[model samples]
Target: MRSHGIVLHSLRYGDHRIIVDIFTEAAGVVPFIVPQSRIGRNGIKASAWQPLALVEVAWQPNVKTALQRPKELSLWQPWRTLTIEPRKTAMSLFLSEFLYHALRREQENRPLFEFVTKALSWFDERDDQFVNFHIVFLLHLTRFLGFLPNVEDWEEGCYFDLQAATFSRVRPYHIYYLEPEESALVPKFLRMDLRSMRAVGLNHALRHRALEIVTEFYRLHIPEFPESRSLEVLAEVFE
Candidate 1:
């Protein structure tokens, strides 16, 4: 089937080949090959597979096989605001990498699609703190991953255990637990929009602690994710 989509992220294969993952509204997620995508600006231009650039898409399953091929690709727009800002650019990189790992092959998730697109639109539109964007995105993403804990568990003195993906009024043995001050951000997080997320004035310690909780959350849910490179980079950006 033919469709339109955007390159979520890509990885280099060998010396020049590239394996591309794209999110298509019409066909969900698919991987494409940009043979020798690295060497020639004539083909992919510059950083074409970076993130969040809309593109033309073409797809069809191989006969007698589940794998599909995505061809007929090109960028739909320049992503002027997303590409130009360093802060937003970093967010894009972080989110795209996470999504590439989280979203599986041949799975269709319309709501997740819309959530990401809208969040990107929010970032593209205005300048804001950019400090707390990842933390807010982590909470919002809980809805898509099916791991959002009971937010009403925000009882005082309780600990948040990222491994169990739950909240208990008692302190957990895991050092990854969130202290009361950090846990207090939950209600505020529940009120955040992607745009308003930037304005969230979480203290540095709480913000870093939030990121740690979210990353542990990802580890529990995503079996394949060994580590997130964006973790350190995002911390520096927030700092």
Candidate 2:
């Protein structure tokens, strides 16, 4: 079968092969074994396996095993700056890690795949003023993952119930909730798309806080979502 996918994670399989977990439009998350021989001049380049690299992949399905062998693989959307620009590279790394965990059990959902591809392409093409891109991306991602916060229910001085995934005028007894001040930012963020995100300026401290809250929100919703190590790297890069 042939499909377009985003490279999520890859690791050395033995000495000669690497196993890549890709979130494909057709197969959700599928691991493909890429042999060493496929790395030379006449075959698929190693760079095509990089995190978040969009690629067209052809693989044979085997009912006996979870792993699939790629018959053909090539970059479907080569990024111009995402791989080279320092900040963009950092963001991509963090996102790739986050998605690996977030979509671990995801089944094939073409709309979700399209949303991710379009968002990443926008991020790659953006020249500057994309500091809030990741936060916005995470916020929007919940829409497809089925835990999207109800921004429409938001009102003045409403507290956001992270566990409930909704806004409440009264604070819940549970601790997993955002205070009104922090909660106000969600509706604002929900309103901002990739292009408009630049207009809502946030200082480094506020941005950091927002990111932390968002991460915690994910932890609450996603089962066994571990803290992302690349998050610190991304923070340092932005700082």
Clash totals in order: 0, 0
Please report the candidate that would top TM-score against the real structure: 2
Query: What is model 1's C-alpha RMSD?
Result: 2.8
Off by over 4 Å in 1: 37-47, 63-67, 173-176
Q: Against the hidden true structure, what lDDT does model 1 obtain?
A: 0.71
Which ranges of candidate 2 are over 4 A from the true structure? none
Distance from true position, residue 58, model 1, in Å? 1.1
Model 1 clash count equals 0
Candidate 2's residue-wise lDDT over 54-75, tens digit each?
A: 9999988997898899999999
lDDT of every predicted structure (CA atoms): 0.71, 0.92
List the candidates' TM-scores in order. Answer: 0.85, 0.97
